[model samples]
Target: MKLIEALPIVLSCQNLSKSFRGRHKQETVVLADINLEIRKGSFVTILGQSGGGKSTLLKLLGGFLPPSSGNVLFNGQSLKNNTPDIGMIFQDHNLYPWMTVEQNVGFGFRIKGEKPGNYKHLVHEILDTVGLSHARKLYPHQLSGGMRQRVAIARSIVVKPTVLLLDEPFSALDVQLRRRLQEFLLALWSEMNTTMILVTHNVEEAILLGQKLVVVGSNPGRIVEEMTISDIQYRDRYHPDFLHVQRYLESVLEGNLKEQGDNYYEEVLAISRIQKINS
Candidate 1:
């Protein structure tokens, strides 16, 4: 076991629920009565079906969205709005087309009106950590999908946020690329030791990246399963225990409601208030 119980609780949710008025003014419930506690410097994965409020929950946790009922606390304080202490990354890179790699990575500081002299060292350091120092001069259009995501990850961490909420940042890549980025993410997590919550529909990725796997069920989405992966040997994809866990999680996801409907997503996005690539 990792003895996470002894660690400080970096983030927590209590009786959380999110809903929004539907087209006809009916409240469409997405997530409800969800309580969670994440230890500091831990990697947690939130897994569920598509449109199952995974992204919505991530938004709530990151303070990117307000919950309908409950509260999200970071280091024991309620999150009212977005804070620099919590960084969010969407599936798309969301890098500026006009900005070069170094510029994009340095943007967190730039947004705060910090001079390049202040953030130059930090940006270059993170870019090199993600193996993108060579691409610092390249534009977003010039990078591959995996490279783009790497930049997004780099951008989020460059600020040294206490928590990094990732919303399927690796889902868009090819299988091979996805695997590579997964490895890269794990390495980043190891180096930074930041509290991370990754929302993904991929079972294998969830098991691989998370020390604790949270399986959320749909239809008024709630966490239905929580598993702690204590053994370090299970990190191997080819390990029998890893394969067994993957199969079990696949079965769990297969049993959930296949869809959350247009109303669900429509209401979700409206309430979540999350920003994406095009935006």
Candidate 2:
């Protein structure tokens, strides 16, 4: 096996299942039988339709939510709760509005009661890497949407976590900005080499970022498909292979929507047919 393939598993989940209790003691199964293994320094992307439990699965993996059954393993040990070794970035950027960019990025150290002198250099290095050094004095409200998200990413990585979970961090941005941030994130991942898992509904984004792509089916979410992506062609959005993979994943997502009895599925199919014909 190749050296990268021989890398140690940083995170894995075995027979993982999660359910929520609703009104009248009813149960809603959000995820089921999720078994996954993520190698160190690898990037994995979970792609599914909205409300398909992609985010829920991410939370379970990060120990932000408890699994109703099975276990999430971190380095072969069962993870019972959130750990500093695991970091998370959400869609909202979740920065302290009152704190400046530098303060927010270094807040992890402050909360742990560490002296600034101990972590100041680390904070500055990460800030400069993310190209946010100039905005270090700016508050969350003072930065643009993409800039704010970068700050959140910087904060999560400043502590040098072994794993990072991103819950659609760029979903809120416009197309151009989202693409820019995606490239920035890819570069950052290359530099930091953190084991990263991102959950998103966007097929293109998933294909663009992940070393492996996992598709979750809805209505009691389960892992329907997993693809190991290594070809450089998959990274180029305009490439034929990339478009082919994108279309296939879209069909998988549409099938899930159809299974849910979603009425918009037919409309989407019709639109897709029209677009193909026009092209």
Candidate 3:
């Protein structure tokens, strides 16, 4: 077994489902029977299109939204509500416009009634790690989109959350900036070893960052496919194997490859072999 597979399960959901009551008491099922297990210190990416309940699944996992049925387990305990141990970052930076970078990153400590002297060093440390130490005095309006996002991330990680749930946090940035942030996030995860689950509609981003990728299908979102990718080749966007898998996943998301089961793996492995021979 892979080392990541051997790690203890840090978070999981059992038969998790969520529904909302709409007008005339109509029930709209956003998610159904989502059973997932995240390993300790692993990076898991959830891929799906918009309105596919990807965000809802993330919220349910984080206890930001309660599941209509089933349970979210954290460290083997059923999660009743959002806990500090699980931090969340959304697509929007959602920074405090009035607070400077330093103040904003330190807000988590302040909200917990911690004194400045208690968390000041921690706030500085995280800011430096995120490459925002020099921008500590800048307010939200003064920072660039990427910088604001970095501050938001710093804010979440400064508290040392065991798991971080991100909801398309880089979707708004330009392609170049998005890639940079993806690398930044991966580096931070490596350093912190925090189990990270990020939900995104971007296929390349999902494969690039995830050790495990779970694809959620729409029409009451469900896991259509789950893949464990360990090969470093998958990390290269231009690699033949990487492109093959990306195209296959794209087809799956577009509802074209539903019946392609074992053939998918065979094709990907075949491509890997071809590349190895050519190299």
In model 1, the clashing pairs are none
Clashes of each: 0, 0, 0
Give lDDT tens digits, candidate 2, residues 1-279.
112355689999999999999988999999989999888988889998888898888888888899999999998999999998999997666899999999999999998999999999999998998888899899988998889999999999999899999999998899998988899888888887688899998999998998778899999999987777656776899997678667767878777545634454455445434432432
- lDDT value for model 2: 0.85
Clashing pairs in 2: none
Off by over 4 Å in 1: 256-279
lDDT for each candidate structure = 0.84, 0.85, 0.88
For all the candidates, what are their Cα RMSDs to the real structure?
Answer: 9.4, 6.8, 3.6
User: Would you estimate the TM-scores of all the predictions?
Assistant: 0.88, 0.88, 0.92
Model 2 C-alpha RMSD to native: 6.8
lDDT of 1 at 161: 95
Q: Which stretches of model 3 miss by more than 4 angstroms? A: 258-266, 269-279
The alpha-carbon lDDT assigned to residue 141 of candidate 1 equals 95
Predicted model with the maximum lDDT? 3
| Top candidate (TM-score) | 3
Poorest 10 consecutive residues by lDDT, candidate 2: 270-279
